[model samples]
Target: MRTAIRLALPLVAAAAALSLTACGDEDASSDGGSGETAADEGGTDADTDAESQDSGQDGEGGSGDGAEAGTDGSAAPSVDDLMGNWFVDPADPGRSHRIVVEGPDEVSFIESLEAEGDLCNRGVYADGTLTFAPEDCLQQGAEPWPDRSATLVLNEDGTLHVTWESGLEEDYTFSESEWGTVA
Candidate 1:
């Protein structure tokens, strides 16, 4: 049962991404893999799913150690807070990527490189961090995009940072699309 849920999460995330394609400026196209990409159109403040509505509410206490901690003494960047479209920081855009996080368990990451590709992963969120399943579980054209590493952190300033098992790190700020901004 656990394995089934794990596999289904990415599939569900992919379906949710389909609804988001219309939000992009570029029409959706196949990448010959499970990954998908769309043109940049910006994000809206709209809510795409019920889960988004409650993402801001922290279920647990905040450590107040990071910038994401609530000034009011509450927690910030709750699990749901990481949902939405996150873009590469314009000031330092490299290998442009737009990551759409859907519920607490699924994410669709669209990266625009010389060879554009995207990947969907089933993961979990806790302590202001999001980690996806291993690459073996998510394949793109016979290979996983990053077969070893998948981790993300949400900074207090509403910026996002991602680290791959390959030791690559990236800083990202939220992108706005007609659909909505990255939560």
Candidate 2:
């Protein structure tokens, strides 16, 4: 469907980072996305290719903050702008729902709930919205996640606005850059 195609990258990397770490919540949803929750190692190359093409920005594009710097309300933030960590209200950030965006088309929408932990979903960035399909979402090693979808928008204050397929809306504040913690 249109929703599936609109989704792109992120979950692939996030799953590797959060597969075992509990985020402190719970989702009752079960596996239903695409009904084909199988891992396809064959698709790795294609994902890499797409990420390289979408991330054309170098080290000098923005203010160096993980969040987008420009205040363009009419324009959607680029994939580079979305790359990093976002989380719901939490003092330590490790105890809430999180979104980790790694590239132009890859987005990992992670929940605090154990049942619906890290969902690596494909995302399409268009018209200021990144639409994602979680049905086909996977963990790092192709671990399957429940079927779902969500719409994401970056706010002027550098927060993330997400509306789940279940009609739940939540705002996540920009955390730190994923790169910062790698070392």
- Residues 1-183, model 2: lDDT tens digits: 433233322344445555554333223133223422211223222222222221222331333333333344412455666666665643333335566666666666655334335454566554445666645454422234433665565554555566555455555655443321222
* TM-score on alpha carbons, each prediction: 0.45, 0.48
The lDDT of each candidate is 0.44, 0.46
Candidate 2 lands at a TM-score of 0.48
Give each model's clash number.
8, 18
lDDT of 1 by residue, 72-171 (tens): 3334355455555565533222234546556666655544322333454565555655565554132323222542344565544445556555555555
The TM-score obtained by model 1 is 0.45
Runs with alpha carbons beyond 4 Å of true place in candidate 2: 1-75, 113-118, 138-147, 177-183
